[model samples]
Target: MTDHVDVLIVGAGLSGIGAAYRLQTMCKGKTYTILESRSASGGTWDLFRYPGIRSDSDMYTLSYPFKPWTHGNAIADGEDIRRYIHETAHENKIDQHIRFGHRVTRASWSSEEALWTIEATNDERPVVITASFLFLCSGYYNYDAGFTPEFPGLEDFQGEVVHPQFWTDDVDYDDKEVVVIGSGATAITLIPSMADRTKHLTMLQRSPSYIISLPQDDPIASFLRKVLPLGLAHRLTRRKNAALAIGFYVFAQRFPRLASRLLIGAARKRLPDDLDPRHLTPDYNPWDQRLCIVPNSDLFRTIRHGKASIVTDHVAQFTKTGIDLESGDHLPADLVITATGLQVVAFGQIEMDVDGEKVDPHEKYVYKGMMFSGLPNFAWCVGYTNASWTLRADLTMQYVCRLINHMDANGYAFGMPDPTGAEGESAPLLNLQSGYIKRVAGMLPQQGSNSPWTIRQNWFLDSRDSRRADLDEAMVWTVRKPVAVAG
Candidate 1:
C-alpha cells in the first residue's frame, strides 16, 4: 500500500505526540500521519505497568508546558502519566491523525526524491508511506522487552518470575515473600511501593547504584499545588526547578570531586554501611549515568522502618528454591522481579541512507542532538540525561515548531545540517567516557569539542541555544526554495 503525507511521525509517545501536535497546528493545510507500533498512546508510560512505578522526577519539570498536569503528586504514577498523554492527544486532536498497529520497521531517505520512504507493517500488512519529512519520537528504550540478566537455571525455578515491563494485573505479591532484582531506579522505585503490599520484599542487586533519597512526596511543590492553582504552581515549580537544575549542573561540571561528595553523601544515607560497596558505587561520574529519582525517596523510609531490605551481592543463578548469589547464599522468594536497567537504542535502530551511500548515523555528527550531518529533513528528540527528561523535551518541541515555521516562512523543502566543507566540516560526536558514545566507537562522528551540541548537556545551555541562541550558530533550519514542477 502507498500513502502520501506531508510529514510522518513515528512512536506516538511524548516526543512523537509533541512533534505531531506542532506539525498539525503549523501545517494546517498539509496532510500528516503518525504511525505507532502499539495500539495505545503513552509510549513508555503505557508500556511499563510494573507495580510501584511512577515518574522519577517532579511533574512540573516532567510535564509538557503547554498543558498543566493536575495530578496531586509532584512525581506522578503510571496511570496519571498515561492519562496525561491520552488527554494531551485528545486536546490536540492528535489521536485522529494517529494510525495504531502500524510498526515502522525501516525508514530510508531518498536524495533523488528528497523525501523519506517509511516502510511499516500495519496489522501485519506491508505499507509504505512517503513524506517530505520524517520525525522520530520512538524514544531510546526498546518496547519489545526489558533485559533480564542470564540466570543459569531460570527455568528450574517453579515460582513465577516477572520483568517489570511485562507486569500484569494477575501477578499478586500481596503478603508473599518477594525479591526484586536490579539496583537501578526501577528497582529502587519498586522496593518501597511493593513492600507495603508484600509480606516481605528484598531488593537483590548484583551491583549497587547511586540511590538518592527524597521524601515520597515533594512537600514544597505539593504545598504549592494545594494552595495555588495548578497553572501557577506549575510555573513556580518550573522556574525554581530550572534554576536548581542549572545550578547543580554547573557545580557538577566545574567541581566534580565536590559534586560527587555531595551526591555520594546523599546516597550513603539511603544505603546501609554493612552492604558491600564494590558493586554499588558507579565508577563513572554522577550524571554520566542517570541518577535515580526517589520522591521523598520512600525507599529509605521503607528500609529504615524494616519493611524492606537491600542486598548487594552478585547473583549466581536461579534455582528451584530461589536465586543463588555469588557468595553461595540463597535467597528464597515466591516471586522475582527483574528491574535490571533498560536497553538503549540509538535513533531507535533505524537506518538512514542518502542515495546509495549509507548514512551511518553512528559515524555522522549530531547537530543540536536532533539533526544528523549529511542528512536533510530529519529530526529526532533525545532528552536530558539528568533531571526530568520532559524539561528538555518541552523546549525541543517548541524549537521544532520554530524550525517548521522558519522553514515554511523561508520557503524551503527541508534544510539539513550540511556538515560539508561549504559550511563547517570535521565535527565529531564521540565522548571519551559515555557507554553509548563508546559503543558506536569508530562508527560515531565527533562534534567540535566546544560545540554546544557536544558538551552542552545542561538545561541552561540547551535553553539558550535552542530557545535564544542565534539560529546561525546551529546548522539546522531550512531555507525554503520553491519545488520545480513536473513537466
Candidate 2:
C-alpha cells in the first residue's frame, strides 16, 4: 500500500522533530509525516551509547527555539537529550505522525506528476510512499558504523576492541587499563568518563586538537530562569550563548595567532606538572577544526588525579598485549577504544532521481546551504560546523516553511533553484578542515562563492538574509495544472 502526504520528513531526531514542529505551526493545515530509520527517535543521541556521551554545544542553542530547554546543565547528557526529544514529540503530538523503523532507500521525483515516490523498508518489508515535498533531516554521518582506520597488526591484539559508537555493556573496562585512540571530541569525552572506573586510561593521539574547558551549568541562565518567565529566560540565554559562540569563532578566524596562544595557555594551566604543554598544542589554529570542550575541566582533573593521561605519538603497530609507538615507547592496554571519527554520508545515502535521471549530489551546487540547485521541492538540513547545530538547522527549517508558503500562495507546482548566472568558484559545501569532512568532501554538494549558492556559516547574516530572501530570484517555478474531472 502506498501512502501520500503533503510533506514527507526523513529522520525523527532533533532536526526532524524541529522540522515537523515548524511545518505544523508555520504552514498550518499542511499534512506531513516523519519517517525514521531507527526504531526510536533521537538520531545521534539514541545511536551513540558511549561511556561519557554528552553534547559538545550548549543546550540552549542546540534545542528548538519554541521548546525551551528546562535542564540546568548547559552540556546535556545523551540520555537527557533523548528524553527531551521524546517529550517534545509527545507534548506537541508529533509522535503520532512518526513511522519508526522506516528506512528510506530511494526517492524519485516526477515532473509530470509533481510528486516524489519514496521507497523504504520496515523490518525488511518493502513499503512505498509519496509526497509533494521531501525534507531530509537525516544527519550527515553513517549510522551503521563509525569510521575506524585500519591499524597494523590489529588482529594480533589480545585485548577486546571496541568503537565508542557501538559500545556495549558486556565489554568490561573496570580495573582494566584502557587505551583510547584519536584526539577528537569522542576521545576527549571518553577519557574522563571512563577514567574513574578503569585501572588507567590513556588518550592516544597522532596530533593534538584545541581543547577548552567550560562550565556544565550556566549561572546566568539559572538566575534568569529564577527571575524571569520561562520563555523569556530561554530566549535571552540562547541569544547570549549564541553571541559568545559566534564571537569566539570570528575572533579565531580573524586573529588566529592570538586565539591559538590563548587556547594553548588555557590548556597549559589545566595540564599536570608532569605533562608537557606541547602535548596540548596543535599545529593548526583554533576553529580550523572543531575545538574540543571539556566540561568543568574534567579531562584535566582526571589527568591531575592520576586517573588518565595523554600520549601524543604515532602508533607503529598493535602488539599482542597493547600498542607499540613509533618512538620505541610501549603502552599496555587490556582494551582498545577507537574513538576515531564519524563516516559522513550525503543525504543519508538515499538514492535520488528526477525523471529517471540519477541525481549526483556532487554535481550540483547547494542553494542557501539547504536546497540543491535544479532540485524541485527538496531540502536537506545541514548544520554549522563551527557553531551549535540547531542554530543553522532552525534557520533552514524556517526558510523551508517560508518557501513552501510562498509556493502555496502562488499556486506553484514546484520550485527549483537555478544557478545559471551564479558567479563564484565552487567549493565544498561544508567549510571545515576536519578529517571526516575532508575525506567525504567530493561526495557532498558544492557551494558557489556568491549569494544564494554560497553557504555562509554566519548565523546573524543567514537569519537576516533568509527573512528578506527574494523567492523569485534565481528560482524556477511552475504553475499548478488544473485537475481533470470526469463529467
All candidates: CA RMSD in angstroms?
3.5, 1.1
lDDT of 1 by residue, 22-93 (tens): 666655776789899899999999898887678877777778776776666777898888899899999888
Q: After superposition, how far is residue 60 of candidate 2 from its true place, in Å?
A: 0.7
Candidate 2: where is the Cα deviation over 4 Å?
A: 419-422, 485-487
**lDDT against the true structure, each candidate:** 0.74, 0.92
For model 1, the superposed segments whose C-alpha errors exceed 4 Å read 26-28, 215-233, 267-284, 419-448, 452-455, 470-487
Q: Looking at candidate 1, what is the lDDT of residue 258?
A: 79
Worst 10 residues of 1 by lDDT: 428-437
Q: What is the clash count of model 1?
A: 21
Model 2 lDDT per residue over 309-343, tens place = 88999999999999999999999999999988999
